[model samples]
Target chain A: MKPSDHDNEHLLHHFSDMDQQRESAKLGMWIFLITELLLFGGLFGFYTFYRAWNPDIFHNAHAALDVRAGTANTIVLILSSVTIALAVRSLQLDRRRRAGKFLLATVALAAVFMVIKYFEYSHKIHLGQLPGKYYHYTGIEGTNPHIFFSVYFTLTGLHGLHVLAGMGFIAWLAIRTFRNHFSAAYFTPVEMAGLYWHLVDMIWIYLFPLLYLVG
Target chain B: MAHATAHKKPHVLPLKVYLRVGAALLVLTLVTVAVSFVHLGPYNLVVAMLIASLKATLVALFFMHLLYDSKLYFLVFASALGTIALFIVLTLFDTLRRGDIYEEVSRPITPDAVIYSDTARFDTAHGQALPEEGLMPLDTAGIVSPPLDTGEIGEQVDTSDIGRIRTGPGEGGR
Candidate 1:
């Protein structure tokens, strides 16, 4: 028997083996991620309805968004995704310390993303380009300009929360890695967390183009 | 258990693969952003979405390791995406159709066809306007009364000319 084949303590009693346990966890995470997708799907549906109904308004309102900030955030998320994936790969190689460092790098990148997002949001708020009834910006020349901002804020806001949650998950993984809790045999949590971070990046992949570029 | 199988090792991709996918995503991101600047008119959305989908596929297949993993994960993810497509398509069908209905229903009535000369209010084609007090019961039985206007209030709302106003394009309730 190979040394790596020995089952570690991470295997649950219900699972027949480590492979089954890891596959189960990964499958469960994918399922939950889809649920998250569905939740965002509803908002996307709302956006489609409004954009279809008032194409002119959506087009005009999109100009209010800072594309520079959005592009920066997009790059930040893609980099974070890389870092987190590397972190998982590190764990797979049993480089626990390196895994923690990569995880911390991802966290730092996520924080930078939030900072850029904060500036964009505050700028919008300062200009009264808010969602719904609070919308008072008079620059847009169309009916119900507020509707576009409403969809924008809601979609990005929810996505931001997901980013925050991913950061938390990665931070937890980093802590666990420092404690020497995971190795090549039992890094399901790190892999799962990496999947989640990628999912978050995937969401931004769509959101960036739709909200900022598509108009 | 029936599902129990031999221990399978996790797949670990090389650093180059991750780096390559990461570079591709960044390039695609820039391409999408750059594409937005060129006015494709309506096709802007199409092109942007296509590029973004390509980027998302790369992330799913490589960074998320769906390419290396079992097909079951891809199945679940693809089905979820299909469901979202149905949600958006069905919703748009309803919303766009409803918009057409509203446009048809709310058309403005033309001003030339005078229904009630006394009030000059566009007759809602229903002719449910109350007849003046002490006046003969309105001949609301589809009688084409002359479009006469005395231009005086309470001058006996001409029941004889009661239903003559041909309701214009605004007659939508029918």
Candidate 2:
């Protein structure tokens, strides 16, 4: 066995071996992801009720949102997910520089997504389409249009927060990649981070259509 | 020759499959946008949600590598979905039941009560008059009626009072 492998064994002492450590970390990520889903799950449940009760208002409100921006963000996130996967793959091949480059690309793509989202949200707010108590779009006049905006803001706001958090994780992984901290046998952190970033992307895949495309 | 036996089997998907999956996701997004233009009533919402779910599945299976992960991960995911489903069903049941109570309470108590009215009384130089009760005239007459104890419009029904509507349990027992 390599001397470095023996030295690395003590680095993650929670497990008896590196394989066990990798498995546990992956499992821990899935559990965290499950909790994350449930957090969004409550908002989704609220949406279903409001949509069923006020379908017309929900549809008309949804029509006001920009589908093009949503679609662009979806594509951007999907591409980022691909790049992050490639970063993991590069790490697995012991190419730290390639992994670092891919991580940087992933972060840049995420920044692009956030920029698009900022414009999308600000445009709506400028048009007096604020959510909940801040809603000022009395022109579209409905019995309770505020409810639709409430669900829209709550769901997308939570998802956007996830994107920001994912960016931080990606930045951390990028720093580690720069330091040549990960190799074929020690890339669990990068892999776990990739899995989480992909989940964030997966959520946007659903949100784009639900909030923007459909009317 | 001995080095060949030491290599571990690759567990990842072929590169072509990933590319194809990516292409399919792109196509699905286009399909979703196209579908949204049609006015399908309630089905419009259903179709959009269904398409979004399909796209989410593709990303989860391929991009997230859940296809090769342990069953424990899937169990965790399934449990989350199950919890969401429970919340949807129970909350909808409660909300829909409340709608029925609203309908019952909104039913008029008398033929004259068929038209909903907001009663306002004004004091003037002349005698008091109930506006909807015809004590006030079409153009010239000015009369005021003290806020009478006429009771609620549906008060005679004994079941659809404000208390019942507010509490949701009085008339919603069924």
Q: What are the candidates' individual DockQ scores?
A: 0.31, 0.25
| lDDT tens digits, residue span B1-174, model 2 | 221122233434666666777778878888888888877866877887898788788877877777876677778878888888888898888766765554432322332231222453432333222344543232244421121245454322222221122323332233
DockQ of candidate 1 against the true complex: 0.31
lDDT to native, each model: 0.78, 0.70
- Model 2 gets an lDDT of 0.70
List candidate 2 stretches off by more than 4 Å.
A1-11, B1-9, B104-174
- Give chain B TM-scores in order: 0.56, 0.55
Lowest summed lDDT window (length 10), candidate 1 chain A: A1-10
Query: Relative to the unseen true structure, what is the C-alpha lDDT of residue A125 in candidate 1, on a scale of 0 to 100?
Result: 95
Docking class of 2: acceptable
Residue A66 C-alpha lDDT in model 1: 88
Task: TM-score each candidate.
Answer: 0.80, 0.78
Top candidate when judged by TM-score against the true structure = 1
